[model samples]
Target: MAHGDITHIDIPVGDTQAARTFYSGLFGWDIAEVPGFEGYPMWRAPNQISGGGLAPRDASFTTPRSYVEVDSIDDTLAQVSSLGGKVLMGKSQISPTSWWAIFEDLDGNQLGLYEGVTSAE
Candidate 1:
């Protein structure tokens, strides 16, 4: 993926199991629980091309948010600020090399940014 490309998406749900069952059966998506991410399960589309996560819903994060891939999280954040957007979450690591962050556009819609290896060697 490249900068501006949607890398991942996070959909908030009240019930993890029920959401998993609904999505898995509805779309035949492969939704499975990740080891460390217990209640939050990752989902892959039927084509097995697009992927994202099904997360527990909360007051501040109840809607589905898409993540755009960026080469540099810091740089992109700076650009976001310059473009009148606000950082809702600072760059944080999901792994040693992978990182993610959330932000709000001028209209207040929340979105995410992803920085790391997007493909396997």
Candidate 2:
């Protein structure tokens, strides 16, 4: 992932299993339920390229969202606020070296920010 690059995407789905089957069967993607994620499934494209996840949609999250990689989640979020975007979700640690956050643009489109892996345990 590079700074300001679309690193991942999330597709909202009503049914995780159905989505998993449809995507995996249709595109030969490797979709599987990840533990500790409440059955949410992540997918890898057949060519082993782009990857994303299928998250159960709710009132707050009802559409597909693309995550843009950033060098610093905190700094990027500050910039987002300064630019008139609202932070829907604060920075959350996805792993020891990675973090993510969600925000809504001026037009109310949801987008995500991802801090790429770092040298951390």
Candidate 3:
């Protein structure tokens, strides 16, 4: 996905398996646990272009979070801070070439930033 695109959406659920089953059955999404992400089951819409994960709900992540693809998490977080937002989570590695971070906007709405090296690149 290109920068600023809505890359992924995380649905916080009390039960991962139940959420997976409900979503897959309801939307006909293909849900499966990826190799490296065992407990987190990823789901892809029938369109194949839209996808997200069923994340275990927690105090910090009580709501669904939308991840926007970004060119640089560091730069984005800096901008966020300058614009009256707060970083909830600093940049963290997702893989050798990928990273993610979470930030809350001025209104306290949380959003995520994702930086990754795609195969197309």
Best by lDDT: 3
Give lDDT: candidate 1, residue 44: 96
TM-score, predicted candidate 1 vs. hidden true structure:
0.93
Better structure of 2 and 3 per TM-score:
3
Tell me which of candidates 2 and 3 scores higher on lDDT: 3
**Candidate 2, RMSD to the unseen true structure:** 2.5
TM-score for each model: 0.93, 0.89, 0.94
lDDT of residue 84 for candidate 1: 97
lDDT of 3 by residue, 46-80 (tens): 99989889999998789999999999999999999
Can you write out model 2's per-residue Cα lDDT over 1-121, one digit (the tens) per residue?
6798988889999988889889999989998766656677789897676888998899878888999999898999999999999999999998777889999999999899999673312
Candidate 2 lDDT: 0.86
- Per-candidate local distance difference test: 0.89, 0.86, 0.91
**RMSD each, Å:** 2.0, 2.5, 2.2
Q: 103, model 1: CA deviation in Å?
A: 0.6
Which ranges of candidate 2 are over 4 A from the true structure? 118-121
Q: Which stretches of candidate 3 lie over 4 Å from their true place?
A: 118-121
Residue 23, model 3: Cα distance from true site in angstroms: 0.3
Return the clash pairs for model 2, or none.
none
